[model samples]
Target: MTKDSVAAVLERLSRLYPKNIDLSLDRMFELLKKLGNPQDDLPPVIHIAGTNGKGSTLAFIRAFLEKSGKSAHVYTSPHLVKFNERIVIGGKQISDKQLLDCLLQVEDANDGAPLTFFEATTAAAFLAFSAYPADFVLLETGMGGRLDATNVVKKTVLTLIASLSMDHEDFLGHTLAQIAAEKAAIFKKGAVALSQKQLPEAQKVLETYANDRGVTLKSEGKDWKIFISKEGFYFNDTLFPHPALKGVHQYANAALAIAAVKELNSKWLANVTDSQIAAGLIDVVWPGRMQPLKDFPLPEGWELWADGGHNPGAAKALADFLPEWNDKPLHIVCGMLTTKDSENFLKQLAPFADSIHTVPVLNALHPGRSPADLAKIAESSGFRNIKIEDNISHALADLTAGRYAPGRILICGSLYLLGDFFSSNKGVKNDRQ
Candidate 1:
């Protein structure tokens, strides 16, 4: 099959199966068995699972490994522009021909068993990684870690859990402990587990789980810690360069990646030079998490920032970074899926936003909170200046027309929303388009 044809076939397969995310490992395991267990053939794996910051952490790891002249394969989810963005081999995205070939191979192996879009794509990634020669493979969980398809991997050199927050409540659970427990399921026996600084309840839950499973638990601030200063950050006993990714919360995420690599201490690549770690931290880039789009349809000196933060914990982290605005009025363009906590998310915006503009995300799978409904939520959350626009373009137009300030424009809420925004701005039609 040709590259376009391969993509078309995968698209068709995605549409054929229901997109509703079923939280279970049975289907993926069965599918992998039929494919001759390709996942077991992957290189030294670094399995990262969390509600937020997982993608950034993976990016950091990839950047550092590449700096050290090591080849790394990465698999992430919910591509911003193209499906090919999800799979990378040897630090490069899979070519069209390679993607098509992998897809065809997986389709032929499936033998008529139904698989979700994510499941099929993951299978294709593992197949590609197994076929290729690389130094390491970084895997990020799609949803809840415990039952996530990526969890089937038996042995991981290291596992890092980033900030755990309340998200996907209907599928994962309602409370924080419940969500933490699900994420902690990624911990494998004898594998080193490095956890970011979590809440008291979540920390206790993860520690207990790791101990019970005989996994060595390295909780942030106890086993290791990151100290951020005006100059940079100190990881463990070493004072390393600051992270390339913006935001104060990123320091912790970068430290987690470094700790994971340090724990591995591969004899083949022993003694990771400080220069490699520094270069990796500086060069790493993860889109849609505080990504700045400098050249948008906005006036000069007007800034636009996009993030995929949707829950209360993510909002609080964003709020902590807001003080750097230096009193510049922030114009927020926000949209969210119906399953999210709209009220809680909006309330966190009160401190940073000068005015809130709400809009419906285009082509979202789940029902989205209408601009009007989100405006109501914003008002009730003590945000007095609230406006509802049909979509992002109109919202930006109105914000630019009004009395402006030397401030940034924040576009946030849902990852799907951010993907749509990027597609619209870049003139590329994605799955949603």
Candidate 2:
């Protein structure tokens, strides 16, 4: 019998449990127990959770750690192109052989018992992280933090919370405070918690939780502030180099990472100098969030970019950054999952776009809203001159044929669509940051 590839093994393991997301730690704990509870042996954890900016924040933190001569084992979810992108040991993606071996071991430990795909994969990541030697494990919650598969860590060195907004309404609660409560569960006693500026309601929830748990919570604006300028941003009066990642929002993300690093400098993560933090800011790369597509063929003066942001909060971030591109008229090419609030998401972007091109998220795991449906949503969201296309390539071809002024083209919305864009477009490297 031939050995199964990583893809085949992942597909088989996915069938061992229900398809829908059942946010609970029961199955995860059970599997870890069978595997001798590798979660307990992991290096000091920096658990992160929130609606958006989790990946970008984690990327910034990893960059800081690497710059300080530290190696970290990191785990994030929803790989854009390959499954291996989700797991990194010592700042490198998990090799296929090691990933397959870990998955097989996790499969054996499960003995065909019930488990979600994320739970099984997360278990494999923990096992691998435990075996490997690293200074810290930077863990991003798969979904809501309270019952997320990665929340199995009993104690963490610190908990980082990024921007919070309405997302995953079904699994996480609908209200902002409820969602904040769910994510704030990651704050452990004796661990410092840091958060980005949040809505008043969400802020109250997080503050209440932190106070009850006796965790010191430092929030943006209240505790630490980032002052942006034409040259660069300042974190709590300490000026830092501009981040390599695009957009003004990144300054806040970098500040959050810097704050976490400073909070840990005295104990778990020492020797992270100001110079190292500045270097990390300049070198950090978090692809698919307003990343330019330099390799794709384009007419002279025409620019192409992509962002994997499906929620209104992400859309607002993109909207805030769009004004900086006033030199060129911006045209948006968007594809979204059916589960997303397409109208709300488009509403945030509608004001800035000269035209909106709607397409289906071809590579999404679940069904995507039809192009026509998305266009209708865009229209309702106050966008005019909306066009429906088969996919991204067709959208670009249409844009080229239109001979519109050499404006900017932004492929926005679902991460799965971004994955499809990367897969179809040759020379586009999906570099894991």
Each model's C-alpha lDDT? 0.83, 0.89
lDDT of 2: 0.89
Q: In candidate 1, what are the lDDT values of residues 1-433, reduced to their tens digit?
A: 2445765868666764645656677888887887889999999888999988888888888887878778889999877767788899998888878888878777777765667777888988998999999988999999888888899887587888999999898888989999999999999886788999999999999999998999988878998878887878998778888786778888988999888777766433535677889888877888878877776757766888888888887898788888888656888899998889988988988867888999997766579988988899999987888889888888888888856665678999988888888777774222211
Error of 1 at 227 (Å): 1.5
What is the C-alpha RMSD, rounded to one decimal, of candidate 1?
2.8
Residue range 179-268, candidate 2, lDDT tens digits: 999999999998889999999999999999999989999999988998887778888888887888887777778889988898879767
**How high a TM-score does candidate 2 get?**
0.97
Cα RMSD of all models vs. native, in order, equals 2.8, 1.3
Tell me the lDDT of model 2 at 108: 92
List TM-scores for all candidates, in order.
0.93, 0.97
Report how far off residue 430 is in candidate 2 (Å). 2.5
lDDT of 2 at 251: 77
Best candidate, lDDT-wise?
A: 2
